[model samples]
Structures are given as C-alpha cells and as structure tokens.
Target: MVWLFAIATGLIVANLYYAQTLIGPISRATGLDPGAAGLIVTLTQIGYCLGLLFIVPLGDLLENRRLIVTALLTTAVALLAASMTSSAHLFLFAALCIGLGSVAAQIVVPFAAHLSRPETRGKTVGKVMSGLLMGIMLARPVASLVADAFSWHAIFVLSAATTAALALLLRARLPQRQPAGGMHYFELLGSMWQLLKTTPVLRRRAAYQACMFGAFSLFWTCVSLELTGPYFHISQTGVAIFALVGVAGAIASPIAGHRADQGKSRSTTAIALTLGAAAFAMPLLIHSSRLVDLGVLVLTSVVLDMGVSANLVTGQRAIFALPAEIRSRLNGLYMALFFMGGALGSSLGGWMFAAHGWTGVLWTGLCFPLIALCVFATE
Candidate 1:
C-alpha cells in the first residue's frame, strides 16, 4: 500500500520535470527568446512553492484522497492547456497551474506517513523518495528523447493523457482518510514562523536540506554547461544523455531507506552527504576526460540522491512521529524552505558559471555541502 503511494508520487511528480528537456524545443517551436524559457521552469517552481505554502496545509484539514484526486485533475487540465498554447504568456500561466497542481505529491508523502507505524517511517519515506528520484532522473533524458522523436507539444499532451489514466487508477487504490479538525489558513501561515523559531529539529533539518538542495541544484545547472563546452563539444542531446548516468543514484535510493529502517538514518544521511560533497571534486581533479565526467556524474548522482533521500526520510521519520494534526503543517514549512533553496541555488549557479566558468560553479557548489556537514555536526 505504501509502495502504491510511491507509484503515485513518481507519476505525478514527473509532470514537474516534463519541462526540463522540453524547454529548449518549446522555445524554438514558439519562437520565444531563450531567456524567456526560464519562465517555464520558474513559473512551475513558483506555483509549486505557492501550493506548498497555501494549498498543502489543507491536507491536515481535508480528506487526503479527495485533495489528491482534485489536484491531479487540475494538473492534467493544466498540462492539456500547456500542450495547446502557442502564446508565451499562456504557456507561463499553464506552467503555474501545472506546478500548483503538482503538489499532490506533498499530499501523497504525508499520507504515506499517516499509513506507516513509527518504527518503519524512515524506510517508508525512503521508498516513496526512491520513486521521486526515478521520476526526476529519467524525466530529463526521456523528455528530451520524446521531444526529439516527436514534437515538443507532445510532451505535455502525453503527460495529460498519462495523468488522466493515473487519476483513474488512483480513484480506486488511494484511501481517503479524514484527518482531525481543520486548520485555518492564517494559523497555517502563522505556524511556519513558529516552527522555524521553536522547533529545534525542524529548524536544523530544514536548514540542512536547504543547503544540500542548493548544492544539488548547482550540480545539475552547470553540468550541462561543462558538457556542452569545448572540452566535450557535446551537443545538448549529449548533455541530456549524460544525465542518464544519474539513473544509478535513483536505483540506490532504497538502500538509503533500508538502512534508515535499521536505526541508522542519521549516520546514513551524513555518509551520503559526505560522498555528495566529494563528487564536486571530480572535475577539479580531472580537468578534461569524458570518462571521468560520466563516472563522476553517476557517482555524484548516487551520493547526492542517496544523501537527499536519506535526509528527507530521516526528517519525515522524525516529523511523522509528531502529533498527526501537525504533519501537514510540518511538511508545508519544510518544503517551502527546500524549494526556496533550490531557487537560490539555481540563480547562484548561473552567476558562478557566467563569472568563473563550470569550475567556478563547482567551487560554489562544493561550499554548500561542506556548510551542511558543519551544520549537521553541530546540530
């Protein structure tokens, strides 16, 4: 049943990544400026951030299944609209809706927490995140291939169709649980500040995730720049191809979770994070080798995903152990910071790349995990 939640997360979250590869083709197809292409992703992130902040708290008050289903329906419609759009503004709007609706994954994750016993919570979260990593890892190269073989619009159209099918499957399989009494919007918003200042665990873990995700974003953002430059002279397609190396990391996510189940979640998290930090050294050590690039990309993907998934599992395990009424609020607070960190990371990575090349970006990225390590050690 929890694995059912995993499938649900994977399919729905894939919608968010659909644009990763299709962004270029979509821009070319619509004759939009390359600079505006970032809007596609930015709008999506904004919408997801909005949903995490505003809509997700409803999971604590509303029926989780109903919220999940309704959100999925909205997501499908948004994707359909994206497929039909030739106008840039319309596409941007559609992305916002798509992003807002995609927070169904938030509902699904906490719902997994609701389903599991305390002892197994880390492992359960790990299982669910494994699915997320798989969706994210495959979404890049796969979406590119789909857009290349077909048309860019085909990406959104197929997403809508697949989403509709998934919605149907979920209707029967997903359990709708009515949580305790409702939380008002103001209270939900208010609690975020309170959680940050008051809950030591929440504060510490959220900070850790923020920094780590910053580094994660840094890795992905600049890897393409490095690959597509003179040393590799690789095409954008080859950059996408290199992302496939991350599939190994996706495969290793469950191991992180399994270890978490044995009461080793924190230790597992630290080790994974340390390995993730080392992955940043790959390019610094070996300046110009395709084999090194591929090897390091795969290894880095493994450690980074493993670290992130583990930390998230650990965090969820701890949070879910709290009173059930506050779980949604907890998630909303944590994810807001997480997403905001990703936004900061991407922006900073762009700056570093522009000013100092891929190596500069790498240097900037290496700082995040080291900072995270220190934070973890002290906390």
Candidate 2:
C-alpha cells in the first residue's frame, strides 16, 4: 500500500511539472513574450493554491476514494484541454485547471499517513513522499525528452492518457476511508483558520517549507531558461540531462523520514536550511570557467534538491502526527502556504531573469532559504 501510494504520487504530481521544461518551446510556439513565459509555471502554481484552499478541504467532508479519483479524472480532461489549445489564453487557463486537479496528490499523502501505524508513520510518510519528490524531480527531464521527440503538445497528451489510466486503477484498488468529521463544508473550511491560529508547530513548519519551496520554484523556473541562453546554448535534451542529475537528491527523502521517526526533525531541518543557502552561494563562486560553472550548477542542483526534499518530508511527518480527523485539512493548509511562496518565487524568478540575468537569480534565491533559516532561529 505504501509503495502504491508513492508511485501514485509520482505519476499524479508529474502533471504540474510537464510544463516547466517545455516553457521555452511552448512560449515560442504560442508567441508568448520571453519575459512573461514564467507565468506558464507560475499560473499553474496559483491554480494549485486555489485548489488547496477550496477543494482540498473537502477531503474532510467527502469519502477519500471518491474525492481522489474525481480529482484525477478532472486532471485528465484539463491536460487534454491544454494539449489542444493553440492560443496562450486557452493554454494558460488549462494549465490552471491542471494545477487545481493535481491537489489530489496532497489528499493522497495524508490518506497514506492515516492508514499507517503510529510508530512507522514517519517512515511511511517518507516512502510516499519519496515518490512525490521523485515525481517532481523527474517530471522536468521526462517532459523535455518527450517534447524534444515530438512536440510540446505531445507532453500533455501523454500525461493525460497515463493519468486517466491511473485514476481507474486507484478507484479499483484504493480502500475507502472517510473522515469521521460531520462538519459542514463551510465549517470545515472555516476550521483551517482556527488550526492556523492555534497550531504554532504548523505555522513554523509551513514557513520553513514555504521558504525552501520558494527557492526550489525560483531555481527550477529559471534554470531551463538559463540553459537555453548564450553561455550553455543547450537544447531541450541537454536541459533534461541536468534535471536527471538532480534525481540524486530524491534519496534524501527516506533518510530524512527515518531520522524524523527518531525524533531528530529539528537538527535535520537546520541542516537542510544551511545546505539550501549554500546551494545558491556555490554558483556565485564559479565564474572563471564555463565548464567549472556547469559542474558547480549541477552540484548546487543536487544539494538544493536534497535540502528541499528532506525538509518537506520532515515537515509532513510532523504535521501528520497531529490528529487523524483533521489530517487532510492540516495537509491542505500546510501545502497551501508553501505553494503560495512558490507562486511568488516563480513570478520573481521570471522578472529577475529578464532584468538582471543569473546574478540576480542567484542572490534572490539565496534570500528565501536565508529568510527560512532566520525564521527557524526564532523557533
């Protein structure tokens, strides 16, 4: 069941990222302005935040299996809509729906935690999260490769087909688990504010992950653009290779979870914060040779990915241990906060890259993790 949940997460979440590597090509095809292309990713995240806020809370009000399967089906329809759209207006709207539908992945993560035993909950969440992070890390490279082979539209076509199949499998296999809460839908949404106001741990953890994710979004959003620029002059295939190399960071997910189970989340989070800051700093130090700079970028990619992935699993493990009945809402609130940061990072990344190039991006990315570290210090 754990492995199944993890694979499901990887597949479903991949929908959110298929657009990242394809941004350049998609922008060119649609005649979108280079300065505005980052919105392809940013708008999707904005839509995701919308889902997290409005739709995800319904997890506490509806049956888990039905809610999740329904979300997946919506994703399939949205992906198809995206693939068929020629105008930027239509594609961007479809992208938003894709992000909204992808929140099913969040619903599933908390469901996985609810099904596991208390002692192994961290480990369980870790393994499932490994799938989620892997989905995120792998999505770019896979999208790049697929888009290069066919057209950018082919990426979503493939995703839509695979997602439809997954929905069917989940419907047949996933066990039913409904939240015991009899709270009305509006009341369930209302309670998230109370949860946020009262839960200090939730606030701190969300802030840390929000900062880490902001850095994550900024780097990934801009890196594909950077690689396509004059220095590297890489094609989509070449950028895919860079994304594949970052998969090394996914290994940190389970390790972080194991440590969290041992009650080491605090120290683990500190290490993650430091590593994230150092990742941005490394690129600044490698200006002498292009070869050296690329190597440094690769190293930074792994280090930063490891930091973000570890901190995310650690945060989820802590939050899931809170209360089973409200687990879905808690998960929604936590993810919504960080993803809002991600939307900000993506918007800034595009604008900064357009205005000041990689120098601007590096310094700005550093600030997110540094801010996270400062916030953590107060805790």
Candidate 3:
C-alpha cells in the first residue's frame, strides 16, 4: 500500500514538471516570447497553489479515493489539451489546469499518513515522499529524452494516457477514507486560516520550506538555460543525463524521516538548511576547467536536492503529528505556501537568466536559502 501510494503520487506530480526542461522547445512551438517563458512553470505553480487552497481541503470532508481519482482524471484532460494546443494562450491555460489537478498527489500523501500507525507515520510519509521527490527529479530528464527522440508533444500525450490509467488503478486499489469532519465546504476552508494562525509549527516549517523551495526552483529553472547556452551548449540528451544527477538526493528523504521519528527534527532541519545554502556556493569555488565546472554543478544539484527533499519530509512529518482530523488542511496550507515560493523563484529565475546571465541567477538563488537559514535561526 505504501509503495502504491508512492508510485501514484510520483506519477501524478510528474505532470507539474514536464515542461521545466522543455522550456526552450515548448516556447518555440507555442510562439511564446522568450522573456515571458517563465510563465510556463510559474503559472502551473500558481494554479497548484490555488488548488492546494481550494481543492485539497476537500480531503478532510470527502472520500479520499474518489477525490484522488477525480483529480487525476481532470489532470489527464489538461495534459491532453496541452499536447494538442498550438496557441501559447491555450497551452498556458492547460499548464495551469495541469497544476490545479496535480494536487491529487497531495491528497494521496495525507491519506498515506492517515493509514499508518502513529509510531511509524513519519517513516511511512518519508517512504512515500521519496517517490514524490523521484518524480520531481526524473520529470525533467524524462521530458528531455522524450523531446529529443520524439516531439515535445509526445511527452504530454504519454503522460495523459498514463495518468488516466493510474486513476483507474488507484480507484480500484485504494481504500475509501471518508473524513469524519462534518463541516461545510466554506467552514472547512475557513478553518485552514485558523490552522495557519494558531499552529506555530505549521507557520515556521512552511516558511522554512518556502525559502528552501524558492532556491530549489530558481536553480532548476535557470540551470537548463545555462547548460544550453554557449558555456555548455548541451543537447537535450545531455541535459536529460545532467538531470539524472539529482536522483541521488532522493536518498535523504527516508533518512530525514527516520531522524524525525527519533526526535531529531530540529537538528535535521538545520543540516538541511545549511546544505541548501552551501550548494549555491560550490559553483563559485571551481573555475578551472569546463569539465570541472560541470562536475561542480552536478555536485550542487545533488546537495541542493538532498536539502529540499529532507526539509520537505521533516516539515510534513511535523505537521502530520498535529491533530489527525486537520492533517489534510495542514498539508494543503503547507504546500500552498512553499509552492507560491516556488512560483516566485521560477519567475525570477527566468528573468534573471535573460537579463543578467547564469552568474546573476546563482546569486539570486543563493538568497533564498540564506533567508531560510536566517528564519531557521529564529526557531
């Protein structure tokens, strides 16, 4: 069941990121202006934030299996729309819907938490999140490879088919979890604000992740542009291989979860934040050769991803330890906040790369984790 949830979450969330590496090809195909191309990633995240706010709370009021299946189907339709569209406007709208529907992955996550015993809940969430992180890490490379071999449109067509199939599989396999809360939709929505205001852990953890994720988003959004530019002139296939380096970071998810289970969340968080900041500094250290420079970037990807993955698991573990009935709401609020940060990061990253180049992007990305570390100090 844990593995099922992990795989489902991974497949579903991959929809949100298929365009990150294909920004160049997608922009050219859709006739989108280079300056505004960040919208491809940013609008999706904004749509995701809106869904996290409006849709995911339903997990606390509705049947989990039904909600997950419905959302996945909706995402399938959006993916198909994306594949078929030529107008930038239509494709961008489809991208937004893709983010909106991908919240199904968030629903599966809390359901996994709800099903686990209290003693092992952190470990369970960690294991499931490993799949989610892998989806995030792999989406770029997979998209790159597919685009290199076929057209970029083929990737979306493939994802749509897989998502629809996964929806059917989850509906058949997942246990029905009808939340006990009797609040109306509006009332349930209202309570999320109170949760944000009242829960100090939720706020602090959310803020920490917001900054970490901002840095993560910024680095990834610009890194492709950097690699494909004159400095590296990497082909799509090479970019795909470069993306595979981050998969090593997924190892940190379960380790962080185990430490959280051992009552070491604070120290784990500190390490994670430190790692996030250190990753940006690495690229600056080595300027000797193009080969060495690429190696440093590879190391940076692993370290940065490890920090984001570890911090995310620890934060979720902390929030899930709160009242059971509010688990979905807490998760919703948590994700919405950080993903808003992600949106901001990606948007800024694109503009920074265009106006000031990779050096500018790196310096700007560095600020995100530095801010996070400062916030962590207050805790």
Candidate 4:
C-alpha cells in the first residue's frame, strides 16, 4: 500500500516539472522570447500557489479519493489541452490548468503523512517525498530526451497518458481515506492565517523553504541560456544531462529521512543549508569548464536537494505533531508559501539573466542560501 502510494504520488507529481526541461523547445516552437518562455513556468507556479491556498484546504473538508481522482482527471485533460494548442494564449491557459492539477501532489504528500503512525510519519512522508523529488529532478532530463526525439507537444501527450494510468492504478489499488471536517472552508483559511500569525516555527521554516527555492529557481531558469551559449553550445540533449546529476540526491533522500527519524532534523537542516550556500558558489568558480561544471552541479544538487527535502519534512512533522485537527490547513499554508518562492525565483532568474547575464543570475542565486543561513541562525 505504501509503495502503491509512492508510485502514484511520484507519477502525478512529475507533471509539475514538464516545463522545466522543455523551456527551450517551448520557446523555439512557440516563437516566444526568453522572458515569455519564462511565463509558461511562472504562470503555472502562480496557478499552483492558488491551488495550494484555495483547493488544498478542502482536503480537510472533502473526500480524499474523490479529490485525488478528480484532480488527476483534471490534470489529464489539461495535458491533452496543452498538447493541442499552438497559440501562446491558449498554451498559457493550459499551463494554468496544469498547475492546478499538479498541486495534487502536494495534497498527496500530506495525505500520506496522515495515514502513517507518529513514530513513522517522518519516514513515510520522506519516502513519498523521495518520489516527488525524483519526479522534479527527472523532469529535466526526461523532458529533454523526449523533446529531442519528438515534438514539444509530445511531452504533454505522454504526460496525459501517464496521468490516466496513475489514476487507474490509484483507484484500483489504493485504499480510500476520508477527509476530517474540523473547520469550514472560510474557517480553514482563517485558521491558516491564525496559525501563521501565531506559530513562529512554521513561519520560520516556511520562510526558509521559500527563500531557498527562489534562489533555486533563479539558477535553473537561466541555465538553458548558459548551455545554449558559447561555452557549452549544447543542444537540448546536452542540457538534459545536467538534470541527471540531480538524481544522486534523490537517491540520498531515504537516508536523510532515516536521520530525521532519529530526531536529528535541526542539525541536519543547518548543515544542508550550509552546503546549499556553498553549492551556489559553483557557477561563480567553474564558469567555463564543462567537466568542472558537471562535477559541481552534481555535488551541489545532492546537497541542496537533500536539504530542501529534509527541511520540508521536518517542518511538516513538527506541524503535524502539534494538533491533528488542523493538519491539512497547515500543509496547505506551508506549500503555498514554498511554491510561491519558486515562482519568484524563476521570474527573478529570467530578469537577472536578461539584465546581468550569468554573473547577475549568480548574484540572485546567492540570495537564497544567505536567507537559508539566516533562517537557520535565527531559528
């Protein structure tokens, strides 16, 4: 059952990343400028934040299986719509739908947290999160490969099919869980605010994830430019290779979870943030060497991914332990802030790349880790 949940969660979650590796092709095929290609990512992120805020809290008020399957269907249909579109306006509309459906992964994570025992909740959530993390990491390489072999639209066609399959699997195999009604819909949002305003730890951790993710977005958003330009001059195939380096950390996540289970999250989080800060320094140092860039990229991905996943689970575990009645609302609040940070990062990365090039983007990258450090230091 747990493994079933993980696979379903991973597959559904991967939709969030289809645009990550496909940005270049989407730009070329759509004839949109760099900043415009960036909007494809930015709009989806904004949509995701909306879902997290408005839809996710319904997890507390609705039926779990219905919500999951309904969102899955919406995602599948949205992918189909995305594939059929050539007009930029229509494509952006599809991206919004994709974002709404993609955040179902967020709902699934918190659901898994609720299903597990307190002693094992961290491990369970971490395991499911590893799938989510892998989905995020692999989207780059996988999308690159698919885009190279076929048209950019083909990526959405495949995703649509995958979403359909996962929906079937989830319906056939996963047990049903119902949502608990602790507060009304408006009350839920109100409670989230009340919690955020009142809980110092949740605010601190959410803020940490937010800031670091912004920096993370800044680096990835402009990396395509770096790869396409003089130094590497790589095609889509070449850029995807960079994403494969991230799998190392995805592989390391289970161990990080084990350590979290041992009550070592606070220290682990600090160390991870410190490593992430150092990792951002890579582009500054290995500005032109392919081999050196590859090495740094892989190592930094390992550290940064581990840190993000660990801190995320730690924050959730802490929140979940507080009170059972408000778990869904808490999850929604945390993730809404988290993905909003990602949008800011992606947008800022695009602007920085335009204004200052890689050097400027690196300066943007520096902000995420520094803020992460402050989060750890103060907390």
Cα TM-score per model = 0.91, 0.99, 0.99, 0.95
Candidate 3, position 81, lDDT:
99
The residue-by-residue lDDT of candidate 4 on 1-379, one tens digit each, is 5676677777877787778767777767666787666788888888888888888888888877778888899999999998887778888888888889877787787778777898888788778878877887788778888988997888899999999888777777656777668567898777778888988877877888887677666666777677777876778887788777766666545666667778887887777677667767866776546777756666666666666666666666677676766677788888889889999988888878777887888777877878878767876
The better candidate by TM-score, 1 or 3, is 3
Sort by TM-score, best first: what order?
3, 2, 4, 1
User: Can you list the residue pairs that collide in candidate 3?
Assistant: none
Specify the poorest-scoring 10-residue window by lDDT in model 3. 281-290
Q: Once model 1 is optimally superposed onto the true structure by TM-score, how far is the C-alpha of residue 186 displaced, in angstroms?
A: 2.8
lDDT of 1 by residue, 108-185 (tens): 988888888777777788788778777777777777767767877887899898888887888888877998755666
Candidate 2 pairs with clashing backbones: none
Off by over 4 Å in 1: 30-39, 235-237
Clashing pairs in 1: none
- Model 3 agreement with the true structure over 1-379: per-residue lDDT tens digits: 9999999988989898999999999999999999998999999999999999999999999998999999999999999999999999999999999999999999999999999999999999999999999999999999999999998999999999999999999989998898997899999999999899999999999999999999998888889989999989999999999999888999999999999999999999999999998999889666878999999999999999999999999999999999889999999999999999999999999999899998898889889999999998998
**lDDT at 33, model 4:** 82
